[model samples]
Target: MAPERYEADSDPTDLSLKILVAGGFGVGKTTLVGSVSEIRPLRTEEQLSELGESVDDTGGVDRKTTTTVAMDFGRITIRSGLSLYLFGTPGQDRFWFLWDELSQGALGAVVLADTRRLEDSFPAVDFFEHRRIPFVVAVNCFPGARGYGAGDVSRALDLDQGTPVVLCDARDRDSGKEVLIRLVEYAGRMHTARLLDTVGRP
Candidate 1:
């Protein structure tokens, strides 16, 4: 069973953490945010049209009717002093112009991966890696999707050592929230390690 929902945190928070939700098209980026957000998520999905037939590859996601055009925005309060702002980037290359602006203050990111179309997530992972952003790979387990172990995914993606890969159902509220929590914790660890490295260097 999913964890119980937390009450709304009306008190101003001591920290506002920004997290980017990035993944390939039709990989459930919006679903993850909508499932866990305390507030109604703002989505800019438009019906898939002929304009994308020549560009957007919908091989595994043919059933998807809509695609995010710009970005998805959502909010969740982790506690009294910490809140999270989720910004989901558009998957298609045409809308990638918005990513820089959305990623400006992100603490980390969650890159949703659909097992059936795993390769599609590579770009997102590369983007974060190239930018030195802390992120986790959350496999979005769709029905009938093949089960792949975390290590297998890590190997396939060529993720750096110590990076985390987790299995999740984007539709589940608790599972989605757990993904965000894992990102926060991982980022904390990385930050601490970097601090230690700096201290030890001198």
Candidate 2:
């Protein structure tokens, strides 16, 4: 038996891509980033004590104290020499300014949606849409959560026909990675389409 030639074969599509994980408050942005990230995820969490109780909502996420103040960062090596830098953005309106800095030079974004509070994702959807950045919506399936079909979410978010929406569980590494891959595929298609358009093709 000959030695396996795995080392000789390298992935042709090995390019580094930066993707932003964005959503509203209490969404699973951190969970999703941590799930697929190969490295120890770097997170900035602030203990939300009684001080924030008067301001922050205490309905679905009442038990949560610590909140992601800045961002959660992680890395995932998709293929040999190809990796992705995942930035889990803070969802609160106070941190909205950070979005511009975090999203600079990024390929696109993955907007995490929680069906229970679908409206919470409005800001994230709007932010990307306003910037004309290519993005995909990933419904994070929390435990015991009701299933909302992609179509319903698309209608709720008022996304365009070209946008891709899919279900995912931020707690599951494979599922989370699949969501990231879907966004990557969408970005690739958009890039190709733009190139074709630039060449005078309809």
Task: Name the best candidate (by lDDT).
Answer: 1
Among the numbered candidates, top TM-score falls to 1
Q: CA lDDT of each candidate?
A: 0.85, 0.84
Error of 1 at 108 (Å): 0.2
> Which digits, one per residue and each the tens of the lDDT, describe model 1 over residues 1-202?
1111223346543667789899998899888889999999999999888987898878888488899999999998776677788989998878888887888867889999988988888888998899888899999988888889999999999999988999999999989988999999998787667777877855
Question: What value does the lDDT take at residue 185 in candidate 1?
Answer: 94
lDDT of 2 by residue, 1-202 (tens): 1111112235654567788999988888988998899999999988877888777665676367778889999988776776788889998777889999888867889999989889999889988888877899999887666788999999999998979998998899999888888888897788677778778885
Q: What is the lDDT of residue 58 in candidate 1?
A: 84
